[model samples]
Target: MTDAMTLDSYLAAGGVLTNPTNVPPRYRAELMKLMATFVDSELAGAAGFADVINQGPGIKERIAAAKIVLEKTDHADRVLKIMGEFGADTDRYATHHPWTARLDRKADIGATRSEHDMRLAVFNYPISGWTDAVVMNLLMSRAVAEQLAEFSTVSYQPLAEAFRQIAPIEAHHGELALEGAVKLVENGASQDMQDAVDYWWPRVAVSFGRDDPNRFEHLRSLGLRHSTNAALRERWARSADEALKQLGLKSPS
Candidate 1:
């Protein structure tokens, strides 16, 4: 939300970096630049969803979602630009992000598939938000934002600084999604609520990352990541429990 940086010209607000020992001075700019690219790519990916492009539950919802996605994309671009100013490379990296792979699988396609096909293919039958995508957006997007909130404070100065600015934007995005989830449950039958919880619970547990050395632990040690995946998963479990119970759904035992 910095001047000349408020999504107007796609620029991120700059901040002072006092922690130089933990994060490399050279990597600071580069990290932010890469972070921007990631966020921009993330927004673009969200837009590509079939549910996002097509009309969903209503016009107002569709428009609102579109605007949010655009703002996210623009915000990422702004941060990416600022990172460049600090000397971060904008090179894109291939992500071995497991969650994305799971979603893209034929059997586990995202939330927009037709009811019959989704039920037939997806192990989880009803992906709570496939109808509006906002359901999926809310659950999945918020997860990403929650992690990034801590990641923004990573020891890497450039990325940490960029994250400080970007976190609020993503937080807004995450809240919008949660609101949509609330709307979904507003008139949702008891069964529907259960179905939503059932669909998300398993995936949530497995959401952390693959069992590879190239994971959060390594990143944390390098000062690229701030928390361990195991720790994060524990935190995620605690966060999800209350929400599950709120809908009369049982958390994983």
Candidate 2:
């Protein structure tokens, strides 16, 4: 059989590619893009959160925010190492863009990426303060959970394993956000929390990206994607809505 056919059959049968040398050109391109998106998002996320660490209400809250910032940067490094194997300039990649830069909070960019990097559009909005940061973190972390779950099973063995290890750490970040939100609600910040949620919900929702069946199927054939964007977004919406309801906050209509 041809090498392409062999690779196709292998991927179709749930095989995993362990290294960059064996990856086909098209698959390599797609995989690099995937890794770049993940790394860029993590770096930007960490940078953004770092600014809010001092704004956390208490020592514990500040510590949690600091840990998130540290771990997110580490996560970006982990994936960037994988990209490095594919000839990406790991050093230059992390430093070339302004990771801490953000658009005005009221700007509406939808899911479109910024010109300089592949970080998700949601990361382009600034956190208003402690409460707003917590709301954005909680909502966005849930989205990250969904995305990580999908990524953990990718056909690239090394990248998939990296995601598997990173998933629990990211989930812990979500738990911290949940704890912070609950405390804020108990401390009479329920309305503020709701307003932040209203502001962040649609922005976070758009991070799941648009629903395109053809693109999804193409990724699926390469074992780079498993679920449709709409399905993943709907799942995140249900979970996020329930989380808000627990804090006595309603999702924006």
* TM-score of each model, in listed order: 0.60, 0.98
**Model 1 spans with C-alpha error above 4 angstroms:** 1-37, 48-50, 82-132, 189-193, 210-218, 251-253
Model 1, span 31-136: residue lDDT tens: 5534643554454444444335445566766766776767665666665565555554545422322112223322443323233211111223223243335544
For model 1, the local distance difference test gives 0.51
Expressed as tens digits, the lDDT of each residue in 1-253 for candidate 2 is 9989888888877888999989999999999999999999999999999998999989999999999999999999999999999998887887899999999878999999989899999989898999999999999999999999999999999999999999999999999999999999989999888889989999999999997888887788889999998989999999988988888998888
Among these predicted structures, which one has the highest TM-score? Answer: 2
Error of 2 at 178 (Å): 0.8
Residue 84 CA error for candidate 2 (Å)? 0.6
- List candidate 2 segments past 4 Å from native: none
